[model samples]
Target: MAQREAFAGIMLENENMTIAPGAAEDDRLDYFVHKDGLTFAGTHLIIDLWGGEGLNDADLIETTLRRAIDVAGATLLHFHIHAFEPDGLSGVAVLAESHISFHSWPERDYMALDIFMCGKTDPYKAIPILREAFKPETLQLNEIKRGIVS
Candidate 1:
């Protein structure tokens, strides 16, 4: 007996199910196959901000986070911010979708930020908020998709 799996007009037998180099495009499997068709899971943004001002202010950090949550279309649950010994701030904004967090190094004029959101929220929308708040001369950004789909 032979087992078979079919996807996007491509049929595969258990013994010879290898995918050819261009099979995905030919069969259109990329269109229909995903983690789950029903959910997008979420997006995580890792941001590095450099040469920014006001990085040490806890009040400013918290306010910026609040604005970021609003811009990202994520619901805020709670928030906490702490100022460091000399001149730094750490903050977290808990959201219904996920969270946004940051740690600042005022001495170097740098800040590390994380923004994670799920569901229908658009995490990328927070970029403008961060830019306006930090005024970074240089920025590095990385995006990652999160969640497991069956």
Candidate 2:
């Protein structure tokens, strides 16, 4: 299926969403990521999934959140999700780096997500994992670099 992928500050289609062959599965994050010649706090990503599949599935949402956290090398402190009447859910996975929060509108096949991580851990690494899991027809992302001290 054709899908959109967005991260950092760029947008690409399926081409950018694939986990490259021979890619290292684990990242050795011994320190926080320093950005642009400064002491950077972290990266924050705002993600939107339109026309996505399984937006109403709370179980799938929780599972995907866990998987994304692992792939991004973030530490999970706590996880909670609440499914609502009709068809929708809101959840969050608290992480040492930050958090990944989810709010789904199954009525419109849309999902919104927030991913933020501190240190050398690669927040960018989680994008593809989410693309593969949600299979959204259109994906949009915006990135913000948090806490930079020159």
Candidate 3:
């Protein structure tokens, strides 16, 4: 006997809905949307920040996460953060409705961030918050819309 498929939809049928390999994951967050006949679809953002003071490791990470949640319209559920004191390398995964995650490093003055949001959640709004949080001398961002093949 063959296993039967559960949900049916172009969004789920496509590889677009699946999260990328080696990407950040947040087990605490589970997004559910049932409206407009569309469910389990959303956007993800990857941000790279450069140029910030190397001394203040804890402050930058805390401030960045808070701003991303409060301003980006992302509902943070839970998070895990690891930082290298001398090198100023920080990694964080923020469990959220849109999705989870952001990272920062004060020593090298660099960071990589990813934010995923579904349903009515808007990820772009978080930009200003990030801008204020990192105050990077140079910032590069990549946005990917996750849903549907066609």
Candidate 4:
């Protein structure tokens, strides 16, 4: 009876495992261990960046947005920029593979940048690059993950 129980236990363990080391085995291993293709549901970031010297240039804002799209491999569907009396503001929304976005307020030496991307995209890279380009005296960054119920 003891030998029979041991054999049954071994059979059960093997039954839960795969026989071949093919795609199915790989998938099983991934499901049991690796998290390679796993991704976040979505990410929303609202950034209030303040600048000091020459950060309010319209050219700079345009260049930064264009460069960001290139670097992130994002798609720019539409953009709206307004330069007010005291300061200028530029807002752009890009339709990216990960998600959508908004960037604005470069006239008053301040800009607000909001980015939302789902799946496999990296929005964090934009922050350090923008910090260097804008040279803000003070900055505020807010990040919120959206649509992550499961």
Which is the leading candidate under lDDT? 2
lDDT of 4 by residue, 7-87 (tens): 542423265353332234443321111123433456667888776444446677767766765565566766555565566
lDDT of each: 0.78, 0.81, 0.60, 0.58
lDDT of 1: 0.78
lDDT tens per residue, model 2, 18-112: 43333144654434567668676678899999998889988888888888888888889999998899889998898877788989999988999
| lDDT (Cα, tens digit) per residue for candidate 3, span 4-119 | 23332223335524432332455534454444465545667887877844324666666666666666566676566566545554445444465555455555667777877775
In order, what is each prediction's RMSD in angstroms? Answer: 13.6, 15.6, 9.0, 16.1
lDDT of 2: 0.81
TM-score per candidate, chains pooled = 0.72, 0.76, 0.62, 0.60
Query: Ranking by lDDT, best first?
Result: 2, 1, 3, 4
Give me candidate 4's TM-score against the actual structure.
Answer: 0.60
lDDT of 4 at 53: 45
* Candidate 3 lDDT score at position 26: 52
lDDT of 3: 0.60
Stronger candidate by TM-score (1 vs 4): 1
Query: After superposition, which runs of candidate 3 have C-alpha atoms over 4 Å from their true positions?
Result: 1-40, 54-56, 105-107
